[model samples]
Target: MSFRVFGIDAVSYSTYSRLQKGLHAISMMIIVWLMTSGYFAAYITRIPEVKEAVSAFNVALATLFAPVFVFRMCVSFGKGYADVLRSNDVMRYAAFVVHNLIYITTLIVIVSGFLMVNRDIDVFGLFYIPAVITDPRLHRWFSDSHTLACYGLALLLFMHVAAVIKHHLTGRPVLKGMFF
Candidate 1:
C-alpha cells in the first residue's frame, strides 16, 4: 500500500511497515528530547536545582527507553543490512552506513549513560536501578564516552535529516512512507 499527496506517489519512494514507522517516530521523539534536555542541563544552565531536575527526568526516560531501543535495533538492523547488500546503488549503501552509525552510536550512548551513573537510578520514584560499576574512575570514563557518543549521534542525525530533505527537494518525498 502507498499514499499520494500533491501528485507524488509515496510508494515510489521508500515504504516502511506501520510497526517500523511507529517505532521510528517514538524513538526519534525520545532521542531528540533527551539530547536537547541533556545539552541544556549540561551547558546552558547555572542553576543546580534545574540541572538536577533535568538530569533526573532524563535518567528515568532513558532507562525506560533502553529496552525499546534495543527492540528497534533488532527489528531494523537486518532489513537495512539486507537492503544495502542487495543494492548496487551508492545512495543505498551510504544510507545504510549512516543509519547503522546512528544506531551504533545510540546504543553506545544508552549503555554508557547507564554505566556512568555512580549512584542508584530512581525512575520517577517508581523503581530504582542499581549502579553496576562501583569504581569512580570507571564511571568517569563511561561519562566521557557517553558525551562523545552523543556528539557523534547528533552529527549523524543532522546528516540523516539533510539527506531526507535532499530527497524531498529532488521530488522524491520519503516522509510519506515513514509517516501516516
Candidate 2:
C-alpha cells in the first residue's frame, strides 16, 4: 500500500476503502469540472451563446451527478465523524470541520441548483426532470443560495488542496493515500 516517489517513500496513510476512493475520484472530477466551467461561463464570457451552452451543460451534468454525490456523502460522513471523535489530534478535528463544511455547501449547491431551475431539467436529452419550484421569487432565492454555496465550496476546496500540498511537502505524502 506504499510506494516510492522521487526517491521518497510515499506511504498510504489513509484507510479509505476502494469504494470510497472510487467515489471520491468520480465526485472530485465532476465537481472540479463543473466549478471551473461555471466560473468561466459566468466571469470570463461575453458571448451569449457560450454562456447559454455552458449553463445548459452544467445543469445537465449536475443533475446526473446528484445521486452519486448523495451516495458519496452517505459513505463518507459516518466514517469521518467517527474518526474525528476518536482522535485527540487538533489537526484531525480541523480537517473534519472543513470537510463537513465542504459537504454541506456542496449539498446546498446541488439542492438549490435543482430548486432554482425555472424550467424542466433536460439531462443530456435522455429524459426530463420537472421543475420543483414554480414561483419566480423562490427560483431567484434558490439561485442566489446556489451561487453563494458554490463560492463557499470553492474556498473549502482551495483549503483542502493547500492542506494536501502542505502535507506532501512536509513529507507526509497524504495525497498518495487517496490514489491507487
Candidate 3:
C-alpha cells in the first residue's frame, strides 16, 4: 500500500485485490498439503504388503479434488479478461488457479498409476481392491499417462513462475500478491 508506480496509487486495482491475495495464499497452502499427501502415498509407502494402501490414498485424494479443480477451471472461464489477465493484483489468483488445475488433472494420472502398479489390496488400510494385472501388458499405458501428466504440469509451472518474474521485472505487484 505504501508503494506507488508512476504516481498511480495501487488503489487502481480496488479492494478485491486484498481478498484475491489472501485466496492465493490459501490456495497455495492447500496445494502444498495435496502434494505432500501425494508424495507420502506414492513414494513413502513402498512395501509390497502396503503398496496398495498408498496408491489408494492417492486415488481417494484425486477423486475428491478432481471435481473441485474442474469447478475452479470452469469459473476461470467466466472471469472477465481484464480481471483474469496478468496483473500484479491478479497474478496470485491466476497462479493458484493454474496450479489447482494441474493438481486436479494429476488425479487421473495417479489413479491410472495405481492401476499400472497392478497390486490389489486395501488402500490406506481401508478399502480392499483386487490387483489390476499380474502381467505388465498395460505397463506402457500407465507409464505414458503418468509421464505425460508430469511433463505437462512441469511446463505449465515453469511458464507460470516465469510470468510472475516477468511481472516483477516490469515493476508490477506480482510478487506482492504471493508474499503478503
In model 3, which runs have C-alpha deviations exceeding 4 angstroms? 1-9, 12-54, 81-139, 175-180
All-Cα superposition RMSD per candidate: 1.9, 1.4, 6.8
Residue-wise C-alpha lDDT for candidate 2, range 1-180, written one tens digit per residue: 778754569755768888899999999999999999999998999999999899999999999999999999888868867768889999989999998899899989999988998999899999999888899999999989989999999999999999988887888877666776
Over 4 Å off, model 2: none
Who wins the TM-score comparison? 2
Cα deviation of 118 in candidate 2 (Å)? 0.7
Which 10 consecutive positions of candidate 1 have the poorest summed lDDT? Answer: 5-14
Q: Write the per-residue lDDT of candidate 3 for residues 1-180, one digit (tens) a residue.
A: 366644434433433344455655554564455555655655687676565554466555544554555454454444455554555666567665775666565555555655665666454455666767676868668866876775566566577778867865676744554444
Cα displacement (Å) at residue 101, model 1: 0.8
What is the lDDT, from 0 to 100, of the residue 44 in candidate 3? Answer: 85
What TM-score does each of the candidates earn? Answer: 0.92, 0.94, 0.52
By TM-score rank, best first, the candidates go 2, 1, 3
Which model, 1 or 3, shows the larger lDDT?
1
By lDDT, the best candidate is: 1
